[model samples]
Structures are given as C-alpha cells and as structure tokens.
Target: MSESSESTIESGGIGLSEDALRTLKLVADDEPIPDDDPGLRDLRALHAVVPNTHRPGHWILLDPQQTAHNLLWRGIEEVTGILDRLTHVPKITEALTVEHERGRWRDGVGSEYIEHADQINARLDQIMASATEELLTAQPRKRSKSLLTMALPRDSALLERGCKMRTLYPYSARVGVHEPKWMREMAKRGAAVRTLSIPFPRMIIVDRRHAFIEDLVFDSSPPHSGWYVTDRPVVEWMSMIFDLYWTRADPWSEPLDQAGRLTNPIQRSILRELVAGLDQKQIANRLQISEKTLSNHLTDLRTKLRFKTTYQVVHWWATAAENSSALELRDGEPFPNFPGTEGP
Candidate 1:
C-alpha cells in the first residue's frame, strides 16, 4: 500500500509531516515506497527517535521506547525473512543425512569472511556458546601454547554441559609437543580426539548449525581468515566429512590395535617408497640410508602390519584409509561414501 490517501488530521494547530505519515504507514500498514522521496530522511529520523508509532488516518502518534523496540523487531524479522530465502537445506542425495541434528540451522546459506584474530575469536566464542549438542572440528595446523590457553576454558565448559566434542587432525598432529598436551587435556574433559594420515580440511562446526572454514591464506600476522556459514546444506556437508574421518580415524585412546599406527619419519618415507613400487636398494639410496637399515624399517613396517610382504603392508594401510570417507557434491544430497581407489 502506498500512503493512505486519507487527508491529514491536524492536532490543534499542529499537523503531521509527510515524512512522519509515510513512516507511520510503513510500520502500521506495511506501505511501500514507490520512489525516492525527500521525506524519507525525516521518516528515518522519526524512526530513530520513536520506539512505537501509530496512525489514526494521517497523523502518527509515537511512544519513545515502544517505537524503538517495534522498529528493532522489524529489523530482526526483515533479516529472518531474508535468511528464509537464502538458507538452503539441500535435498538428500544418494547419501544419508547425519544422524545428529539437535542444533541444525534452518536459515539459508550466508557467509562472512573474518580477517582479524579478535573477530574470529569472537565468532568462535559465539558459535561455541550457541552449541547445545555437539562440536566438530578439523584443525590441520600446529597449535601454539597461547592458542591452547585461549581455547581451554571454553572447550572444557562445553564438555561440562555434556555436549559431544570431537576433533580431527593429521597423523603428524600426534607428534607435536603442544598438540599432545592439548589433546590430553581435552580427553580428560570427555572430548574425543582422532588422527588420520590423510589430509583433512580446516574447519569447525557447532551443533551442525554453523561452520567456520579456515582460510588458506596464512600470510597475515595473527593469521585470521575464515567463513562463518549457517547454510544447512553446507554445515551438514561438513558434519559428514567429520563423521567420515571419525569412522576411519585412529583413536587417541589405546583400545584399538596399536599395529600399523607407529610411523616414524624415515619409516613413513620408506612406506611411501614401497607403495610407489620402489625396490629396497632404490628406497634406501633415496633416503641415504644403508640398505640394511632400510630393510630393517621395511621389515618392521610389515611386522607392525602383521603382514610378511611390503605389498600387504601397503594394502592394509590403504584399506584403513578408505574408511576416511569421501563426498560427492551435486545439486542433490551428497552421500558420504568410500570412493574407489586402486591402492593406498
């Protein structure tokens, strides 16, 4: 509706301005502005000063606090309506939806990239605080003591609330000094931690409702850059990746088989060589190791895998890796599955 064509009512000698009347129409009657009107500045000013507005015909009545609250709620609803359109939950494709949806966000996808450390941390704090059920994270980089200090309290608080927490890291994360300390502290707080040799994305998902995908740019001083995502499909997709890693990942605990898990740098290199079909002498020469030592490490690798042959060791490692899960993204629901591979 455009402005009510009703004649303006004068209160005593005073009359409502065109801007005030237009503004009243918007709040009370959902009127549309057909074009740029000079009166809009006054309308905006009226909205700024008044919390509640009403109109009987053409004149507007305003209550200071109520008018502001009314306008504030309208702004929030405006945002919600916008989100209702953009937030998408992709239709389930060939894959199964993640079982946990306690904190799923219905809002369509929208994103912001954070560049400052303070902004990123604040966003993280907000997400973690909002999480009512679970927190999933994949952090592929090294942790410094300072970062761990900042994270400790917030993470432990979530655990206290009985929220399931799971984190993913590369196998190398297990070797780092600070990583071990942080992992142990979190484990004590009832969080599950796992390591996969395969490369993992750097991201964090809170209650399946939000995801923060880390930026690949590491050049900034404080190193802050990532997307804060609330799109259902995107968050769910991230959840599946975390779950896939969870299934194939080695537990930070000792309940699982210790076999094939201890891979030192040299041994890891040798295994890579073997998988490349390098002979013992060729592998030894490349690593500048004596053939005898190379053979020892290779033998240890096979023994740890409980297989007599180097090929068997490679096959075993490959099989364990397949459980890491793969995703095929399409317009439809993407199911998490193990894509076919020739070998590890």
Candidate 2:
C-alpha cells in the first residue's frame, strides 16, 4: 500500500479499502455519490455497521450467567458484609492510631468530646423544659381520644403559662353536640374558636418557635401517622396565618343580639348598608332610593354626629351601630316619626 493509502486504511478502518476510500474521498471533496457506483454502495454498507468499542481504560464484560452471579447475588452480599464490618472499624482504627501517636493527649481529647456532648444535651434540655406557649391546631377530622387528650393538657399548660389560644374546627365538628360544648368551654377560658367548611392542614405552632405539622398521608390510627416536628420558617408562616384568622374572628364575648326595634327604617337601612362596606351608589340601588336622597341622608348623618368628612360620618355610624341590635318594626306599627320623614 502507498503511504497515503495505509494512512487512510488506519484512519477509516474497514471502509478504507482502495475503491471505498476513493468514493469517500470524492464525497469529502463535495462530489455526491452516483447511483451506479459500486464503491459508493460498499462505503454506505460499512458506514451502516455500528462500532461497539468499550470506553477507554474499562474493558470489563462478563457473560450473562457470570454477570448475574457477580452483580445480583454475590456482589450485593459481599458489599453488605464489607460495609457492616467497616461501619465502626474505620473510626475505631483512627482513634487507636491517634492514641498510639499521642498517648497522654488522647484522654484529654476524649474528655473534650464528652464536654461538647454535655453542652449539646444541656442546650436541648433547656429548650425542652422552657414553658411552651399557647398553640392552635386544626385537624380535618376528629383524632383519637388519646391523641386529643394529650394535646388538651399541653394546650391547657400553655394557656396557664400566659399564652393566648385559638382553634379552628371543621364545620362537621359543629354538627356534633359534644364538639360545640367542648369549644364553648375552651372559649370561656379565653381561647377563640371558629368553624370553617373545611379546616386546612393540621398544624400547631408553639410560641412562634416550634411547629408540628402533618407530613404523612391522612390515616385514622393510633400512631395516627403524619406528624412532623419542625422549628423553622414553617412556624413563622403558620403563626402569621393564625393571627390573620384571629383578627377577623368574632369573639364569644359578642353575644347574638335578639332585640329588633326600628326607630327609623330609612336610617337603619342606611346604617346596614354602611356596615356592609357598600358604596353610596350600591346602597341607593339596594334601598330603591335615589342617589340625591342618599347623599342628603349622609349629610344629615354627618351633621348629627358632628363629623366633617364622609369618612368621619361612616366611622361614627359604624362605631355607634356595631353593638346595637338590628332595627325592626312590629307588625302594623307606624314608622317611628323622625325629623327626616318628609323625604321619599
């Protein structure tokens, strides 16, 4: 072979035979292969075969039976045995080596380890012993008696430690007679309680530092699975959510007002609209009164309350009406004669 032909054969492997090499050179030189060329067919056939060379420096390949015996059963058993034996061996050997090298100081090092461990234990004990604060938790359904009973004491203890408590219950709990009574008792002890159609995730945050949340799937069992104790951003987030709900909640102190006697139907209607957070236009629409009449009533309210702006009028009305019973007129009773009765 010529020097160039030998070089081509070495570089291109099986496809570098004289005729095939010539065809490939023509293709490389931008000449398309002609349909009638036998060299082109040979080159194409060689190119179609896949090269299965192993990666560099790794030529290990076992037969199927050998692979199964080595990798599946024997290899795993061997690896596990080695790991088990070596689990403590490395540390033990390292310690022995260190002791041999520094005999007298080894005792000091061991004492240092004990001292650090004691410090860690003391810190953890302090955290555990610190009186926990009030906590509010929500569960989707009634938990086991034992679980709830345990929680109740913790809750009471927290409350006794000057922590304010609140709890949310699913609406289903409201249907249970016992549940409401239990909630009422909790309320009497200064804990706020509310019921929602569906109470969200079961969560408890203690003193805004520690939180326990459900991490497992909801299951009804003793080891009522799905409990996770965390002390991080989760606690902060849950505390904020609890405070938001607490602010909007109607406290048990505000008993339902049953007194309904209307001195002025129009004024009471306007007051209701104001408390409902409606704009003047909306109030007029609902009351079937014109915008001008609504404005006139608002002006009268402002003047009567000695207020300067419309906002002041609203604030005065809301403050005055918040605790008052809703206005009502007895059957066949005449509308209470007020100064503004002349208007439509």
Candidate 3:
C-alpha cells in the first residue's frame, strides 16, 4: 500500500488491509526463518492468527490468549482520552482565554489610562447613570468646595430618584452649623444621618451592586478623581470594614448629654477625654485598654443617655451644668434687701 494510505490507516489505528496483509506475508516469507531461529514457532503461530482478528498487531498474534487482556488496556486508554479532553485541554483553553480577555480589557479600558479630570468624571457619571436602589456615603470632617459642589447636585438627583441615602460624619461636624442644617434637610427628605467619633473610610455603594472605594493613594483626595469601582467581592469587603466601625458608633436616637453626669470611672474617663477633645485611640492608650474596649464603654454611655455623636454628649453635659448653676443662683439670698432696708 502507498505511504499515504498507511499514514491514514495508522491515524485511525493499526489495522491490516488486504493489500497490506499480502505485502506483510510476502516479506515474512522471503525472510526465511531456520528451524533453530529463536522464537520461530511463536512467529509462525502469530502469523496463523493475524488474519483472524481485526487488529493485526503482535499482541494478538503472539499471545492470542491475552486478547482479553487488551480489554483492560483499552479501558485505561478510554479513561485517559476522556480526562485529556475534559480536564486538561478545555481547562487550559478556558484559562488562557480569560487571561487574554482580562489583559485586553485592562490595557484598553483600565482606570490607569484615564489622565484627565473629565475622564474620571465621565466614568463616575456612567456608574451613576446605572445606579438603582440605594447610595451610602461617608464624608470626612473637612469638605472641599469642589466635592460639595459636585456632591450636592448628585445627591439631589439621587433623592429625586427615591434612593435611600445614609451618611456618616465625625462628631466634630456639629461645630459647623452648615453641616447640621444639611443633615436636617437631608433627613427631612428621606435620608438618615449618623455620627461617630471614629474616622470612617471614604466609600460609596450603589444599589449594593457597585461600590467605589478610595484608592490608598487617593484616600485623602476627592473620590471621583481617584477611586476603584467594582462589584460584590470588593463591595462586600468595604461593607465589612464599615460595619466594624458602625457597630462601635453611637446610635442617632440617643439624646445629647451636656452635663458631666457620667460619674463612673470608665464613663468619666471617656467623658474627660471627650471634653479634652482626645480621640478614641488616645483615650484607650491613656486608660491602658483596647480601643475596642473603650468604644464599648462609650457605647454603653450612649445607650444610657440616648445620645449619638460625642458632640451631643458634651453638649448635654454643658447644658446640665448650666442648669445647676442657674438653680444655685436662684437659691442665693436676694441682693435687693441690702439696698432697701428702710422699706420695713
């Protein structure tokens, strides 16, 4: 048979055609095997059975009894074939495809390529356009004019869409009249406001689907200018971080205690630090306790007075002290008696 035909037959599996068998017989006949030739009897036996089975390989010829043994080998080959196709080839192809796609997308559309402020703004606008249900924000004590300018308009638009809004601020914001006024207005129009002494991470989650976190380098900058936007995995990570602080934060329903009425040593310690404007970490260090433990005590105090922000706590303490002083002045003897002794 031709070499091309032989290659085609080998590609399928080793099988003897009539022409190939005729050629094999002629070759075996011409190669005369003497009676003393090693394994001459075995060769003659193999040639006898070569035309009987479909596979004309030596295994069937030399050991026809081991034909059943080929079943075990065939089973192994079948299993190897399946594993190569399913587990090896397809998995490698999928991984390579994913990596190639990721490289192309990142190289072409990644945030690192955005150089201008307008490019960043445009990206955020695209995100905002798709937001559906809710938006949660945490802003720092100090606000920038540009952020406020952009945020106020965006906040208004979100409110009009009936999105639920929640904002967290530092207690120091109470010193700014404008912040409280803004909070009150936002609260009046379906937003909730809360305050904590702890500093909050700058974050925004839209509809629980997309979240934007301030990049480490841009933590102190405007978020729209430098932030990462992603889905669940990143958002859930930021949400956990927020909950770590939120659990320690005082509830908004608590009324402010202005008076220094917190007399317990731990409560008083926390109160003194608050009055001194020391942060929670400093208070924890001074008292030789963990910040988490200090926060627990503060939370206990908040529950007692029904106050939220540390500012409200201090404000309540001051109000109580003023009331006590006014009562003391009322109890003092009238000064008029000294000037009008002749009235008797």
Best by TM-score, which number?
Answer: 1
lDDT at 256, model 3? 41
What is the full ranking by lDDT, best candidate first?
Answer: 1, 3, 2
Q: How would you encode candidate 1's per-residue C-alpha lDDT over 1-344 as one tens digit per residue?
A: 22422122222112346665556567455444333443443544435432333522233345758766866776688789888866554534212242122113212236655657778889899879867999998876677889889999999999998899999776656656688888999999999998754445788899998888875533332456566888787788778777765665666764433345455544655666777788888876555456887778778877766887877877775656422323111124344563463356
Model 3 agreement with the true structure over 3-101: per-residue lDDT tens digits = 544443445443454444554454355443334332333333224323323333322233545644664576579789987788677768877775565
TM-score of 1: 0.48
Show the lowest summed lDDT stretch of 10 residues, model 2: 109-118
TM-score of each: 0.48, 0.34, 0.41
Candidate 3, residue 60: how far the Cα is off, in Å: 98
Question: Worst 10-residue stretch by lDDT in candidate 1?
Answer: 5-14
1 or 3, which is superior by TM-score?
1
lDDT string for model 2 (1-344, tens) is 34544454445333355666666566555555555555555544444211224432112222436544543564468679989988989879877775554444224421111123234334333433464665666554654455455445555556677777778654445545456666766777677776533125566555677555543422222243233334456566677666544433333344322344211344556766777888888876555456887787778767766778878766665656433442232224443343445678
Which residue pairs of candidate 2 clash?
A: none
Candidate 3 is scored at a TM of: 0.41
